[model samples]
Target chain A: MTDPTASAEPPSGPPARRRGRPSRAASAGTRDRILTAAREEFSAHGYDKTSVRQIAKAAGVDSALVHHYFGTKEQVFAAAVEVAFAPALAAPDTLAEGPADGVGERLARFVLGVWENPTTRAPLLAILRSAVTNETAAAVFRRLVAAQLVRRVAARLDLPDAELRAELAAAQLVGTALMRYVLKLEPLASADVEEIIARVSPVVQKHLTQP
Target chain B: MTDPTASAEPPSGPPARRRGRPSRAASAGTRDRILTAAREEFSAHGYDKTSVRQIAKAAGVDSALVHHYFGTKEQVFAAAVEVAFAPALAAPDTLAEGPADGVGERLARFVLGVWENPTTRAPLLAILRSAVTNETAAAVFRRLVAAQLVRRVAARLDLPDAELRAELAAAQLVGTALMRYVLKLEPLASADVEEIIARVSPVVQKHLTQP
Candidate 1:
């Protein structure tokens, strides 16, 4: 099987996808491959060391093609991080269906759920590694996380300090990620998901609902 | 005037600092200078790119002097991070004097207080930059933070799951540091310290006191 994430069309199927726009970059699934390569490379080598040429080589594309689609190394990282954060970005809307009181549990479970999966966790870790080490990369991550995730959740709160509340909630989850995933400190690392959720969800609820 | 952090003895007055062990490295304050340079170099260039020769150059000493005092770049980082985290390490014990009910506020304010000061915050940001990007450096940092601070705080809580509780509290503060200091995301970043403490203390309190 050709990597299922590349495109909807099967590998044995036709060369073209999206009949209206026949751009080879999209049609051939080269962009997805490049992103996959970029995430792996960045995760392995970090932001400062990883180069556009390396990402292109890993993607089996010319450097020009990587640049044509993603611009600079920083830009490539930005795009990769955005894709990594997709589940998190959609969380506010998808988890907002319940009453505000339950928003904490819903959001906590959802955020932790993303980290619980190794596939999703890797890219997010890459984004975090880059942000912590490189200022330019940090700016990209800060903008995406703030404007895309936290601010959206804040907007749903309809409170004066909704932004701060959302940020605190983000900080809590992000901090846990650093320790449990990156640092792998136990028993936080080894604790069952249910145990963590039971302890953390109430804190999340308090941040969202407290006056 | 000599750098005050180097030693109590005047730079011009006496070469012997402790008089017990007049080791030239300790007496002349060469060790202190190396550490200072190491912290600055690591902060400026990051862990992977920095070298012992460069640190020695910045300290105005021979590379052998750096090697003599600190052994390796990673060892130098350990020493620097330990110094950087001294304030935080002292906190679990010093701040524990208050009633259990006030542990949250005292701990929150104290941790934020460490971040509030630019002098203490820089080395921490440097350590964080290294830990996120390099696995070896991350291990050094993980051990220091987990053993020196979190575990100590856990021991104090006297709860069965005190370790997890302390880790959660740490996650809260560390997360705030990433957003507020490293990422500089606002209003969390630009927001007044008092305002943050007020909003955050209650969350911290719940993490520690909630069983």
Candidate 2:
């Protein structure tokens, strides 16, 4: 390796083209760092309360870097939320291969899988919290979840009003999450995920496929 | 007949035991003052954002007086949200008495009553905003809403899973509200409440009473 003080003479020719590997690696690292801080800030403080500076500080980066990478606070939040809910999007594919004897059980398994994982759960908590405080955040969250999670499940059913039913089913699952994880309501908070799916999935499936 | 200077003296002997009529008037006025200010504060800045001090200042009263009258911020918020949702609460009772052949029409009328009025809509926004952000607020809101509005409707329905259906029906109503008002989403936002009710109420009624 060259000495620490040695200059790269080739870089002075044409603005020194950035090596794709280093830039891509640097970009991903910064992006991940921003998301980590955003998840924490948004969860604890909420959307309206969470500032760009706070997130940047937490991530140990300049605030301008966050802005450069994500563009705005909402974008940063949306990116974090997208990552948070990514598992739910993968469920449709997973469920497709599972035996059809018990769609409800499969769906419940998918839902619990997302909510139980610390990686997914924390970001979802932030989204849920933000959805209540900032209207813009809620809209962004609703569109993302509706399209990625709710609609996929809905499409699996053949019903006239599958869209509305899907929304209803989504509400139940989301409501349970709110009560158990966020509100810490009793009985539900203590109940196992399998039990919750056993109790709640038939209701969701009924809404989905039933007339 | 007493001298003007003597009239000012602590009302002479034991304050004349203050009469009943003016006391009632004063109490009503104080209650009204507190509610009116609370509404304005909750409306202007939402539940989590508004403080008792802000409300007290708006109402031209001591913050202690506001607490003395309402007990807590939640109590004040509950009152506001209750007043906001009361008009819609009348739906179950109206459905109980009205023609069942036009169930959708009747239900639509009742839903419109809540959405069209600013007094009802403002505090509702505050409560919903709080429900999304604060766990304590969400628990109280869910309890108050379920007991006062949803349970009443569910009790009138004779179905295998009336409670579950009730929750589902509520999800329809609340989810729609979240979309239309909080998100101010397209089509749903500009669409007349009557049209929404016409479209949605049948689904609600079906969830409630259908096998």
Candidate 3:
């Protein structure tokens, strides 16, 4: 493609400055690059220590371009968290795919499975580490995980105190992740994923379906 | 009371240089002060950002004196964790005072009660935040928690995989604390303590006592 919009780098002429807008695909690519860089920077340095300029440097872009794309560091962190957790956040919808009786098992398997995978675990771990120490980051993380993931799962269930139950179930899973992944506590940290699921799913199931 | 060891501060003048040792109580008090300062420093700045010099300054002691007392920052952190968790870690022994069937409820109440109290929660939260980000800190924290807290509770259970079950129960409670305290996730964070006990104790009870 010889299309002017298809170029990965901006054209090297005065006309490049005059261009009204880049193609939608090109904009999306730049946004994705910035997000990837932000995740890496935040993960390595945490919320307080990381800056937009550092993120932009990591992304090989101008700092002003990062501001143009994400506005503020908090907004950038929010966007990064949204990307990191997108898969796990979508996992609650799968509860509908299985029989009502096995929903707990399905939910446990889904949540833990996301954590067990290396591909998703790295970025998610960074967000979690930062969130644990930084209040602002924690707030964004709490809002996203609660609203997008936990509450949605609660809504699907027909039970009293559904939200509370859903959150309780989440506590079990989230705690497991914190211990096994973050804290690296023994037996739990080294134990097989299936074993954890076996022990924890029933608890989750009880929280979800039981009164 | 006339003994040189009874003095709160080092005795004034040349006599101080000739003294063999301070009173045991005074030494312990100095150590306690240092540990308290270490906790505050770690809490405010976390592991990487905290310094031995900073802790010494806060404790109103020379940096060399801090080293003489605690040896290293890691040792200082370990000591701080021990002091911070002393009450909660001791709660397991109380399980012996209650009936087997009620162990889960007692355990949940005891652990959550420790978290509910502000005196212990502040320093413990610092350790948790440090553990989440730094591997060395996490390892030290994991060892102390596993050895001092989780395994001790597991040992009391007559059930098979008592350790695993104990850890699983811990996961639930720990998860609840992470969400409610650290992440401040809603419903769970704001919910009445008794309601949380009513909902979570049974799950914890199941994990510990059930197959």
Candidate 4:
């Protein structure tokens, strides 16, 4: 038995495997662990109530390790928001630079994509759930949603009230998500994505270029 | 003094002081009381979690009385929403039908008036908060806001995309409230109504009629 397994003596043998610019498996693995724990903690406790130590404890790592990896709670939230909002956020920039005629389709596809993705939708649901009761979390959410996403879309449009129109479009889309996914309303909840787009895209187009 | 007090009892005791109504109190008073209680409960617990029995109990009445008055929880909620959204709901149909120059000011004044009135604002805040986490609440909210408010405003305008534009305006205004009152963010929280109107009205006007 000793001859057969001579190389497995050290329980932490993986640490020795990194001999250069850091192994992808080691650093990426720790980062993933931290994010998974942070998502759970933030979703459960909300933004204002969630703490670094709590997140670290859940991740089975030292608190210092969380700070070393994520920097701050806001940064972690931003990263999470980036991931959660990526489909929608990425859409505006692409749509602005893409074929202008089908902006409605692009916008609808973007919203449906994000809401349909389970990985991002859960945290987004938590964020929406917390936004009402928790003031601080709501602020973070508003900034990420309004200033970051809607404002950017507004800036891209050539209309007179582009900013306002963009915000309006954002509201309908987000409100639909709140109603369908989080609230689980009847007709809307059961409606297919294409149906949602058919009904809603024209509305978005109106906002973008109706002037 | 005691002799005079005893003598006054002989005069039908001032008509027995009338236990329930008619003593300078209308039947509507009970409705008002129940609505007030419902607002407080919904604000604290949201719509899905708040029960009619709880609202009735808080109003110091029997649950049967609540059912007798409002018929069902949905009706009661609808009444509460109507009262809370009265300003916007009651915005003269003339505003939408009239010439569209000062619509920015009109819309701004209407929104500010609703937010400033405790009677309306409190219940509205509860409804808006609940919309974040509850589906039934959100659907009702969207129906009320969109049909009563947005559709009316859109119908008044001649633009092809009037409905979408009106919705966008609502989003900006509602988003501002969420940031200020619900989220309690700085600068926005402290900003005066006039300031908000000045900044937001042009945007609203653009949505209303910008060619």
TM-score against truth, every candidate: 0.85, 0.72, 0.90, 0.60
Candidate 1, residues A18-40, lDDT tens digits: the string is 35544565545887988999988
Best by lDDT: 3
- The fraction of reference interface contacts (C-alpha pairs within 8 A across chains A and B) present in each candidate is 0.78, 0.17, 0.84, 0.22
What are the per-residue Cα lDDT tens digits for candidate 2 across A92-149? 6644666555665677567767887777787777786677667778878878866786
lDDT at B153, model 1: 90
Off by over 4 Å in 2: A1-27, A91-119, A142-211, B1-23, B98-113, B116-119, B157-164, B184-203
Q: Which TM-score does chain B of candidate 3 obtain? A: 0.88
Candidate 1 chain B least-lDDT 10 residues: B9-18
Residues B60-108, model 2: lDDT tens digits: 7667656665657887777766766666678778667766655545655
Q: Name the runs in model 3 displaced over 4 angstroms.
A: A1-21, B1-21
Candidate 3 interface RMSD (Å): 1.0
> For residues B128-206, what per-residue lDDT tens digits would candidate 3 score against the true structure?
8988888878888989988888778878887668877888898899899888888988888999999999888898889
lDDT of 1 by residue, B1-211 (tens): 2234454433332233434544555545777888889989988988888898899889877676566666667888898888778877877884478787889899998999989999888888888888877788888998898889878898888888888998898889889888999888978999999998888888888888884
DockQ of 2: 0.20
Q: Could you list the CA RMSD of all candidates, in the order they appear?
A: 7.1, 8.8, 5.8, 10.7
Best by TM-score: 3
Clashes in each model (backbone N, CA, C under 3 Å)?
Answer: 0, 1, 1, 2
Q: After aligning candidate 4 to the native by TM-score, how far in Å is the CA of A89 from where it should be?
A: 7.1
Q: Give DockQ: model 4.
A: 0.17
